[model samples]
Target: MNISKEIVENVSGIDIVEYIIENDNGIAIGIINFGATITKIITPDRYGNLENMVVGFDNKSKYLKNFLHFGSVIGRVAGRVYKGKLTIDDVAYNLDLNLNDTHIHGGENGFHSRVWDTEEIYEEDKVGVKLRYISLDGEEGFPGTVETKVVYSLNNENELEFEVEATTDKTTVVNITNHSYFNLSGNFKENILNHYLKINADRFLPIYKNGDISGKINTVENTVFDFRKGKLIGEDIDKKLEQLTFADGYDHPLLFDDKIGKIELWESNSGRHMEITTNNEAVIFYSGNCFMKKTPFSKKDKNRRIALCLETQNLPIGENEVFKENSILRKNEVYKRTTKYKFSVI
Candidate 1:
C-alpha cells in the first residue's frame, strides 16, 4: 500500500510529513519528517491489543524543545568529537560543542535538525520508506555538501530494518544510527534492569583523559563493560567507571571480537523478547541515565535508567584504526550499513 502523504504542523511554521505503514499482522509504523524520526510503532500483543513499542514525545515541538534526541536519526557523526574540532583533508573544522566541550551528533544543527524529502516504496511483498536529506557545505561547520538517505523497511517476518547511505563531495566523517528506546514488555517499564542483555563484544574502546578515544580496546572481563555473558544492565552500571562519569552510563562503543556475519543482542522480560542484529562491528549501549524524569517531552516518566539505546556504529574518532578502514568512503565509493530489530513472545 502507498503511504498517504500529509502535512502535520510541528513548530509555529515548521511542518512534518507522516508516513504510515500497515502490515498484515496489524503492526503499524508512523514516521515523521522532522529529523526523519519514528514517532510511533504500533504492534498488537498476544491479546490482539495494539500498543506503541517505542518511547517518544507526542508533539513535535517538544522534540525541538527537549534536550533528548528521541527516536531521531543521528548523524553526520553519532558520537563525540574532541574539543569540537577535526581536520579533514588538511582543513581544520570547528563545530558546536554541545556536550562537555566536545562536538556530539554532528554539532548543534546536525542532520537531526533538518527536514528531509521522503519517498514511500511499496511492493507486493515488502513496504518501506526512504528519507533523503542533503547537508550543504559548512552546515554545522562540516566541510562537504553531503547527501544522505535512510530507508526503513518492515518485512513480513516482523523485522524493522534500517539502511543508511551517504556521499560527500568533501572529506568528512559520517556515522548515523537510529535512536530508538525499546521496551519489549510494551508496558512503559520504569527500568530495563530485568531485561536479559547480551552483547557480542569481547572488548571496548577506552576513553582517554581528554574525553576522546584512547586508541585501544580494553578487555571486558571482571569489569563493568563485560556484557559478553548476557547479564542485566543494572547489575554493573553503578560500579564506578571514569567514562560513565561524563555520560552517566554506557556511552562507549563495544568492540566485537568477531569480524564476520552479524553482531547480535537479546533482551527478555515478562515473556516478551527482542533481538537486535547488525552488520556493524560496534554497538553503543546507552541506559538513558541522562534523561530527566517526568519531563514535559516524556509522556510517561523518563527518568535516569528508563529507556536503553543500542546504537550500532563505528567507534568514536581516534579509538580504533579499524574505523579508519571501515569508515573510509572515497570519492564515488559507497558505504552501506544495515541494522534490524525483531520482537516476539516466548
Candidate 2:
C-alpha cells in the first residue's frame, strides 16, 4: 500500500492538495482536500484494463462548479429537512433554504463546498487520509459547533472504507454521507441502466415531485421501487408509477433491512462488481435524473443516467419525529458510522 500527495490548486489563498492512495493490486483512489472530494477511482476491468469508475472533473476549475456533488462529503445532514425548520429540545432553528424552500444537503455552503484539513495515514495493511472539518455554530443555520472527522482508507482487498466520527458542543442533529456517482463501466462507456443492483431494503420513502419526502413508509413489494431480488436499474425505471414519475428516476430513500446483508451493484460488460456495506439505516439511490446535458463533466456526452449514487446515511429528518430524535448528537456524545465499498471482477 502507498499514499502520495501533491499540491493541486490554491483556492482563495488556501492550498488544495490531492492525495492518491493505491494498493499492490493497482486499485487507486484520488482525493482532494477541497470538500475532501474524491477525484478518481481507478480500478481494473475483467481484462485488467484500468479506468476511472466515478464521475469527476479533470480540470481543477470544474470542481468549483461541482453542483452535482460528484464525489464529495455531504454533511450536517445528508438529505432535505422539512421546510427548513428544525427543533432541538424546544428550541426552534431555521436552516438555510437553498433548494426551493427546502434545506437540502446541509445548505448552499454545505460541507461539500468547504476545504477540509487532511492528514495522511500510512499503515501496515492499508493506506488512507483523514479529513477533518469544523462546522461552526449556526454556520448553515443549524445549532451547535460540530467537529467532523472522516477517514477514507483503501486496502489490498480492494475495499475502500469510510469511517466518520463527529461531536457537537451542544444538542444538534447530524447526518453525513458521501455523494459519489459510480459508473462501473469505468470511463463512462455506457449508462448505468444496464447495471444490476440489489439493495437490502424492503421499504422505501416516497417523495414528492420536488424531491421532498412525503413522510410515508411504503413496502417495496410488487412496486417499481423493489430491488430485493436484484434487477437491472432501467428495467422499470421509466414506468408511469407515481414514485418513478416524481423524481424522474430512483431518488428516494430506501430503508435498510437489518436481516439482509449488503447492497450490491454489478456491471456485466466490464465484469466489475461492487458490494456496499453501511451501518446506516437507509440509502438514497439516485439515478442521476437531474444531470443536465449542458454541464461539462470529466468525460463528454455525460447526461442523465450516466452514473448513479448510493448514499448511505440515516433517513432524512424531514419532519419525522423518530428520525429527528435518533439523529440528535448531544454534547459529550460521539457520532460514528462506517460504510465500505468492496470491488472485484465478476
Q: Which candidate is the best by TM-score?
A: 2
- The positional error of residue 127 in candidate 2, measured at the CA in angstroms, is 0.4
Shift in Å, residue 250, candidate 2: 0.6
Clashing pairs in 1: none
Clashing pairs in 2: none
- Clashing pairs counted in every model: 0, 0
lDDT of 2 by residue, 260-328 (tens): 347999999999999999899889999988687544454445587899999999888765443687689
Q: Please provide TM-scores, in order, for all candidate models, with all chains considered together.
A: 0.89, 0.97
Task: Give the per-residue lDDT of model 1 (tens digit) for 150-234.
Answer: 9988867777788999998877777888877765556465476656688878888777655577577788887788787778777
Residue 218 shift from truth in candidate 2, angstroms:
0.7
Model number with the top lDDT = 2
Local accuracy by lDDT, each model: 0.72, 0.89
**Which ten residues in a row are the worst by lDDT in model 2?**
293-302
